[model samples]
Target: MDDTFSPSRHGLGHSTNLVGRPSAWMASPGFNDAPVALHIWGVREMNPALFTMLDQAETLAEAGEAFLAYMVAMFGIDPEQRDAAPGSRKRFRSSFLRLIQGWGFDSNGPEGAVLKGWVESRFGILPSFHKEIIPDTQGPVWQAYVAERMQSRFHDNAILVQLDLLFEFCQWAVARFAYPGQSHLTLYRGINAVDRHGILEQQSRRAAVIRLNNLVSFSSDREVADCFGDRIITTRVPLAKVLFFPGLLPSPLLRGEREFLVLGGAFRVSIEDI
Candidate 1:
């Protein structure tokens, strides 16, 4: 959420709804009603000491406004439209924070929480549901696990995109290895492409299996392939997680042509190009 994004450079025009025009790899359906990967419980859940920092003299409405502003500062949601309505900011707080706590199907904090139980039941990681099993050291594997879980969860309801992660890693590789200052990370996926969302079953699934098999092809990773191999890469950082640590990923990892993105399907390290 870096506020440093130049509008002309980043292409975030004066658009309010981001439902249609996401990065090419993302596609429209993914943004429309995609799965919620990681939803923080609340503004209070953001920092343990946040509630203590609030001002008692301020009205709850003003307090909520400030809270959302603080969140906007943290997440860096673009100021696409001016926030001008009287109670709009507070309403943002009530809705966004409330949705964070209530809407996400899974989460990574606290015992007896709604998201925690959902994660447990969905992934079959029961009994120790609240335990922090995703280790910091196992960064790649932890991320892959999350992505796979997201795919499984949204299989019936959402259009998942693993493409952005690949693009990010590719850009990372180019910036890290190609040229230090010549970091060209802008990989644009247009907004016109479309894909199917309806489930493929019966003869269709078999036909899909045959058609996909027929279209399959492979090539060696010569230097040229290594230069732009994001098409083959699939690891990705979740959007929710990326908001917190914007610069943790270096570009070098993305450019490597090996199948390093998916390590045993338990871990993944992918990047979006843009």
Candidate 2:
């Protein structure tokens, strides 16, 4: 596990070395107000050996199978604890599986919090919401627990690693269907918070710098995105920015058409009509 972001970071007075760059050097000089960051780590720096196994797979299904297999192999859960019989929940999922499940229940719930923490640790994109707006990272509100929530709950979780594999697999699948001329996929997200509070900067009437949550759901269908909000925010997401999408997993877990899990950062976006 990467100790760069430990649960005891605040308490232990430890330094957190962010993996992703937040300065928006990728943006042009005029669009520098909004710091755009893609949630990714260098393959060579963290785990070069991991993708060597991916070199053998040819098809999407095969890649998915390989992804699941690699995830299970990497799960460090105790064998006896893992094999324990399911009681009330029908078929009980392992600790790692619950993080994904938790995301379904509510994006502001415990699972969502942990997943956001994982994104922050790995991608350096801080979460913009907790129960409410995380206005300031240095404020008293943030110091209360920080990310100890991730460390305290389910001490035996490999969900972060599982999500990492899931992201890599999604990235691979996105590349498989890459069009010859296209560099980005148009993704839409409907948002309600257009006020002074949530937005990082109100640069213009149509365009503003908004800080999205570390991990967020978006739609490829404009109608679906419109259904969620009074205002629609459309972003031309590069294939690399997509973390996960529907149909990527054979399991019914990610069921839906044109839905996506996108990595978040400060993005200057135009608000479109709903």
Candidate 3:
């Protein structure tokens, strides 16, 4: 049982020496002005073996499985605990199976439909792209559209709760091991407060603009790249340190402004004296 639970055996060996540092980007002037909440982490280094495993995932299902395995290892969940814990194995199995089934184009598949349904039922919005009009030759266009829609709907408490879970997971991953480098792993989590009315109005207008743009740029056999001159760039940062919001509560700094409830502080396992 111990062997099955060992992180080292599961490719999560402790090699990277991660140290947490304050985020300079979060402290930059006017950084907090954006009407959105965000949590950013500055990972100085990551375990090469872990990266290898991540790279090996060929599909979303595989990636989901890998994620579950990593989480289990990181949390040091033994076999017995995994079996005994309510819904532990079931949750992992469901997610893994769902990922394997795949979220199809424009979320037409079961998983995507379910996700869309849940979001719509909870938040009263559904992400839709006119497949007949906009030739989503580049599959990611619709995916991006869905992501944007979800981001705009972040004002819902249910969505915020979901975000909290995601944030907690990241915190747990960072806490589990250290990166092999001089700098430490940094995790930044915050919510950007946006005016609900203003954002919805803007989103509606943006949809119109996108539609008009697509019509003008339409070509029967257009490649995704030519149709949309967009490229994704990835970057890695090693070290950074800065601090803002001196105390835990942001109320002191945001007295007259709209109040924002900070949720999900740094994730740690500790006992508190009641």
Candidate 4:
């Protein structure tokens, strides 16, 4: 499916050797804080092939599609069993790994090598997910179970849950990489955006200050309705030309032509507004 991420030595057969170590991937903040990781591998070593795919990808949509395909090949739950096990909430950590391998990652197989190479060449040699590393840890199962939950709750819009994960990665990057003084970074998956409510729910716990640019939009009106109804905490800054529906933002604080609403939860109103 990923022509760009296809292994260069495709005919040479798959290699079982996981080239790099998982400990190296631990550099990411997820490993430090959470008992489990978000993705199968680390981000340090970008695979030549994966990079090539990303480079050739024409538009944002195409890039996102390609990424989702990769995610499916690595994570998406079985469609048949998708609705079979209902109302089940599993751990995030175990679920994440199981999703990756469930996409068909085996240590012994031809496709395994190809997939591993695709993974390694794209993301770098991954750390061996040895059973010992997480011994006796009841870390939550992440992606797969989450995907299942989304599918059950939202039905056709299952991708929204995964999108939230991608944006969550962006948030993690901002929290960890951005300079301490740069707290004003824009929240790409904003609070008011309907589709972003899932992400905003997660962000409410961590971020105190966030930026909302004018360019942001969502997938559906229902998403917007879901957003406001969720009772998540966040503030929105309107762009110069843009104006949100007054009903959508019940607590609007207008400054000149633009409105800046402080939907209070974790954050207090600024002195100027107070």
Candidate 5:
């Protein structure tokens, strides 16, 4: 008898090797081709209280608190648990405040040194030095210097990772609001960019979806819908993958319309067609 063929050595039961096998759960199931309804709404249409709270927040902490409150109210997150957790909303608020304050002060002082260290660690780049003409003044010159450094820093890979973490927090915060039977939600920032056609598009004219594994696995052709009050827009594509891009709610697009929060759902049709 060959020992290699023995059932005791190997097992009588059948086993499957799932390594490198494509997941059936990840399949699109033709959702991209299905017709989808869309909704376009002003800011006021979706959670007016949240809009009000955001508007009233004067400081970075206040603004972050308002955002967290909005998440709890809309998505049913436990406030105590969320606040106590590492990388909590409070931490994000603190980081945001630090970023702004760091830019306002002289880079040689204690606060400035800590800020520079943070930037170096988080962004993996030593920010280029800008000579300060005035001492300890948060004036236009300082603002310009900081802004220029920040813009350059934004190009770093580590910044993208930080942005992705922020986006993940945003998604986790609002995931409860996802449509029935859906386990994932998309989050994106609106952008204005020149396409291959050489046309300069307006803000909200293009959107860059957050680059998370769950969100990016789906086909780009798939559409999503969002509803705010009486307004709705459907048939949007999850085109570009991004992190830390701004203009999520462009001022020009929301000039006359009321403020509204963006939501995500699966639907059909390209965002450009809407």
Candidate 6:
């Protein structure tokens, strides 16, 4: 129990209406309960093989290879390419570092939708943005997200599951050494409009309960985050919920930025206007 978030409310803010088996899509009942659902999906229980590799591996590079191999065997994501085929939504090959890079390219695009959808299913956190605001799990925003997620999977069949691996690995590594005694990453995110994000509860003018996009990129470097927008919000993201971090993977593509890709739920964050 990270004291930053209290279990008093027991929900993730507002729940969106999904037609079919709700558990398949949204694992937890509400905003605060999202973390509770992760109990069952702890990679050790859900995926022992991957967890073992992350635990026993000596180097990050070695762990990264085993990580990719798991995806290759499980999803048939072979013949790794750097990027998806241009305009080919029906098929894709860039699944290795796909989720992050593709997401960095366009969070509202096919890759972004898939990543967000995966978070919703696994972590029970819904996406905050997909071309527009997604207040609830119904209507055009949710429909568009579902369509985009399904379409992107045509490229790499198990890309969504592959992302699950990414999260598990990040948690394993961070646990070993995360600023010692800190379970949350001290990260910053810059946004042009805080209103556009889902502010579930307004604790104060400077702080609020914000429901973030399921898979969101944040910067460990405050100055770098400031470059993205005029308003800045900094928060403590639980290490268990982090998906990707700088140097977590050996790929050169991730070397350029001090960014951490965090799985989002409703967070009590402090806002500062630059």
Please name the candidate that would achieve the greatest lDDT relative to the true structure.
6
Order of candidates by lDDT, top first? 6, 2, 5, 4, 3, 1
lDDT string, candidate 2, 104-202, tens digits: 556666666777777766665566566665545787545542654455654454556566666666666666643324456677877765663245567
If scored against the real structure, what TM-score would every candidate get? 0.19, 0.72, 0.24, 0.26, 0.23, 0.75
Off by over 4 Å in 5: 1-151, 155-158, 178-274
Model 4 alpha-carbon miss at residue 142, Å: 18
Lowest-scoring 10 consecutive residues by lDDT in candidate 5? 1-10
| Residues 209-251, model 3: lDDT tens digits | 0101100111111232132223211111122211111111111
TM-score of 1: 0.19
Model 5, span 1-274: residue lDDT tens: 0000111111111122111212221112232233222212222354466556655755444655666555545444444433243323442322322332232233233323334333333323222223432222246744654555455322333433333233333332322221323432333222111121112122354332111111111221222212211212223332211111122211122212222122112222123332
Evaluate all candidate structures by whole-model CA lDDT and list the values in order.
0.24, 0.56, 0.26, 0.27, 0.29, 0.62
TM-score of 6: 0.75
Candidate 1 lDDT, tens digit per residue, 1-274? 0001111122211232122222222212232124233222232343434344334314433433444454446444333212223223432321122212222222332211322223232222211112222323235634544454443322321111112222232233333333235411211111110111111122331121000100011112333333433322222222321211112222121122221111011112122231
In Å, residue 82's CA in model 2 sits off its true spot by: 15
Off by over 4 Å in 2: 1-53, 76-96, 138-140, 143-148, 177-182, 200-204
| Residues 72-178 of candidate 6: C-alpha lDDT, one tens digit per residue | 67776644444444354555554746667766666677777777777666645556567876645657866887898888344456565566566666666666644
Which regions of candidate 3 fall more than 4 Å away from where they truly are?
1-33, 38-67, 70-93, 104-106, 121-124, 129-208, 211-274
> Which rank order by TM-score, best down to worst?
6, 2, 4, 3, 5, 1
Deviation (Å) of 213 in candidate 1:
39
Judged by whole-model lDDT over C-alpha atoms, candidate 6 comes out at 0.62
Scored against the true structure, residue 159 in model 5 reaches a CA lDDT of: 34
